[model samples]
Target: MMLSARLLLAATALCCFATTFAISMDGFATGHKCRCLTTTSEVIPTRLFRRIEILAPGPHCGNIEILVTLKSNNVVCVSPDEKWIIELIARISRNRQQKKPEVFSADQHVLK
Candidate 1:
């Protein structure tokens, strides 16, 4: 009976520790919402990029990165060497140009 009591106490202590650890770790998770703590060099693959932006390398003199904004509104960097990524960027730009609303001047020139 004494041994059983000790075992039960140990189990209770372990459960309390686990619960405390979990609660303590929960606060740290929110720190990663921006994810700036992670490596910034990752270039992810995206099927569809809603926007592509080219930024000049600053003091670091690094290669140009294609900032791809995915359909879900998340932004990530992509390499330009990937043919598919380049093609997708071109397609997006073309589609954007085609979707431009034509403006008509007061004179009705249909402002090409």
Candidate 2:
């Protein structure tokens, strides 16, 4: 009887370990979770900034993550995908393109 009891206890411990491993590996069997924090105000950035990333929904988690990298290397997430946000991103893209410095040929150089 004692031998049978020991086997039962070992089996129970093994089952518990397996359950924990599965949960941790699969993230509760659902998927990875993603959380994004965005500003509530509609105030867009004025200075030039990096690309406006468009994050779509996926197994990573619910909602999207819009990362707005600024000139100061500050990253801000703009959630809700609002019309104004989209427009703002477009404006930044256009401005960055226009801000590119023009390239000149070697013949144009006259160094003293």
Candidate 3:
């Protein structure tokens, strides 16, 4: 009876471990998206600060997309697809300064 109990416990533990491994491999599991934080600031002039949301999956992290709607100019524009939202912000900064256009990586979903 003692031997059988030990074996049952061992099997249960193994099954739990396997289930956890499988879930982690799936990527973007439940409650995983809440780990990130976003901050918004006005770029001045016609553009107003807006919120950032993750539209699609990414490689290590995830693809961060920013939605900006200009209240004064009455226009809405979404940042182009990029690996990180920071790159898009950099481009906007350049444009604000009347500098050359910048390019950033568009690859979002990258499996581990």
Question: For this target, which candidate reaches the highest lDDT against the unseen true structure?
Answer: 2
**TM-score for each candidate, following the candidate numbering:** 0.41, 0.45, 0.29
Instruction: List the candidate 2 regions with Cα displacement exceeding 4 Å.
Output: 1-31, 89-112
The regions of model 3 sitting more than 4 angstroms off are 1-9, 24-61, 72-79, 82-88, 91-112
Q: Tens digits of per-residue lDDT for model 1 on 40-70? A: 3444555565776775654333455666677
- Looking at model 2, which ten-residue stretch has the lowest summed lDDT? 23-32
Q: Is candidate 1 or candidate 2 better by lDDT?
A: 2
Residue range 1-112, candidate 2, lDDT tens digits: 6999999999999999988887444356564666564454455655555666777887775576777778878777675557877777688789999999988897897669
lDDT of each: 0.64, 0.71, 0.54
Question: Model 3 over residues 1-112: C-alpha lDDT tens digits?
Answer: 6999999999999999988887545465655552334534434332254433344556444645455545454333344443344576676678888965656578765569
The regions of model 1 sitting more than 4 angstroms off are 1-52, 56-62, 69-75, 109-112
TM-score attained by model 3? 0.29
Model 3 scores worst on lDDT over the 10 consecutive residues at 38-47
What clash count does candidate 2 reach?
Answer: 0
Clashing pairs for model 3 are none
